[model samples]
Target: MAWMSLLVAGLLEVVWAFSMKQSAGFTRLGPTVVTLVAMLASVALLAWSMRVLPLGTAYTVWTGIGAVGAFAVGVIVLGEPLNPGRVVAAGLIVAGLVLMKLSSAG
Candidate 1:
């Protein structure tokens, strides 16, 4: 349950981040609202998951998911650059996330 919450939270984090970019520095009303709502939900779920997950593990995984997810969204939806270096960096983050989950999701 906690892991599920954390995963959702992480995904929400990505949603909020992308929405924030769409918000245009909070000038856009619709995206701004989405960003705020997703942000709150993401944090709430993170806190809930923390009740069962180790702090380091939960936080690391949360940020890792958000980071890699955001990168993919940027490249795919936003048409951001897709270079080898960026791909490797994102892959490393995913590897770290998997390792962290293996070691701490016990």
Candidate 2:
């Protein structure tokens, strides 16, 4: 449950981040409102997950998930280049997150 919440929060973080770009530095009203709401929701979910998950583990996972999701959005939606180095870096982030989870379980 906590893990699920964390994942949702992470995804929402990505949503809010993308929305922020559309918000035009908060000059755009609709996107700005959406960004604010999504950010608050993401933080709330993170707080909820923290009740059961270790702070370091949860935070790393949350940020990692957000980073990966945003990267994907940038590649797919924004047509950002997915170069070899970027792919390797993303893989490393995932690998680190996996290692953290495994070590925490043990």
Candidate 3:
């Protein structure tokens, strides 16, 4: 359950990050509001997950998920570059996250 919450929080983090791009320095009312709301929800869920999950583990997983998710969204939805280096780096992040999860299970 805590892991699930962390995943949701991470997803929300991605949403808020993308929304921030559209915020136009907070000049755009709709995107700004959406960003704020998503950010708040992300934080809330992260905090809740921390109650049951170790802080270090939860934070690492949440951040890893957010980073990967945001990068994918940028590449797919925004037509951002998906250079070989970027792809390799993302794969490394996923590998690291998997390793962390496996270690933590012990």
Candidate 4:
């Protein structure tokens, strides 16, 4: 399924993003390799998903998932800040993603 591929790609995007932080500008070998691998895999999956999904809709969904996922990871795993403003912003992103999904379905 294209949607499933897109979902995995979005998750990989989150992984790569977090790995990038750990990479320390590519100075750290292990994290750098992980970041590169995840980045490649995420892009490959995203490209594959584009074969079936609309370009605009797919891209928006991919980035929205990545954004929300990364934010949650930061808060839950990395002990990053989670203020009211961020919560509201994340909610808005989720709302937009829901609208996009609904529109794509019909």
Candidate 5:
């Protein structure tokens, strides 16, 4: 399913983003490789999903999922700051994503 592919692509986006941070500006070897691999897969799946989904919907949802997922990982794993404002922003992104999915014909 295109939507399923998009979801997986979004998750892969999170993986790549975290790994990219771990890569330390490509100074590290292992994390750099992981980042590159995940990035490729994420883009590939996103492109696949785009075959069926609207471009705006697919791109927006992909970025939204990645943004929220990376935010969670940053807070939980990296111990980044988690304030009320950031929480509300992430919630709003989720709200928009929900509305986008609901409005989609697919």
Candidate 6:
């Protein structure tokens, strides 16, 4: 349950980040509101997950998830450059997150 919450929080973090871009420095009202709400929800879920998960592990995984997700969004939806280095970096982040999850299981 905690893990699920953390994962959701991470995904929300991605959404919040994209919405922030769409918000155009908060000049756009709707996306700005969505960004703020998603940010709060993500943090709330992170706090809920931290009740059981180790702080370092939880925080790292959360940010890793957000980073990779945001990168993918930037490439796919935003039509940003898709370079090998960026892809490899994102893959490495996922690998690290997987290692962390596996280690946490024990």
Predictions in order: lDDT = 0.98, 0.92, 0.91, 0.94, 0.97, 0.96
**Candidate 2's residue-wise lDDT over 1-106, tens digit each?**
8888988999999999999988999999999999999999999999999999999999999999989889999999999999999999999999998998888741
Query: Stretches of candidate 4 above 4 Å error?
Result: none
Off by over 4 Å in 5: none
lDDT string, candidate 6, 58-84, tens digits: 999999999999999999999999999
lDDT of 6 at 66: 98
lDDT of 1: 0.98
lDDT of 1 by residue, 1-106 (tens): 9999999999999999999999999999999999999999999999999999999999999999999999999999999999999999999999999999999953
Which residue ranges in model 3 land beyond 4 Å of their true spot?
none
Candidate 3 C-alpha error for residue 99, in Å: 1.4
Of 1 and 4, which scores higher on TM-score? 1
lDDT of 5 by residue, 1-93 (tens): 999999999999999999999999999999999999999999999999999999999999999999999999999999999999999999999
Model 5: lDDT to the true structure: 0.97
Q: lDDT of model 5 at residue 63? A: 99
- Candidate 4 differs from the real structure by a C-alpha RMSD in angstroms, to one decimal, of 1.2
> Cα deviation in Å at residue 43, candidate 5?
0.5
Question: Per-residue alpha-carbon lDDT of model 3 for 1-106, expressed as tens digits?
Answer: 8888988999999999899988989999999999999999999999999898888888898899999999999999989999999999999999998887777741
> 2 or 3, which is superior by lDDT?
2
TM-score of every prediction relative to native: 0.98, 0.94, 0.94, 0.95, 0.98, 0.98
Give the distance in Å from residue 7's predicted Cα in candidate 5 to where it truly belongs: 0.4
Q: Candidate 6: how many backbone clashes?
A: 0
The deviation in Å at residue 31 for candidate 6 is: 0.5
lDDT order, best first, reads 1, 5, 6, 4, 2, 3
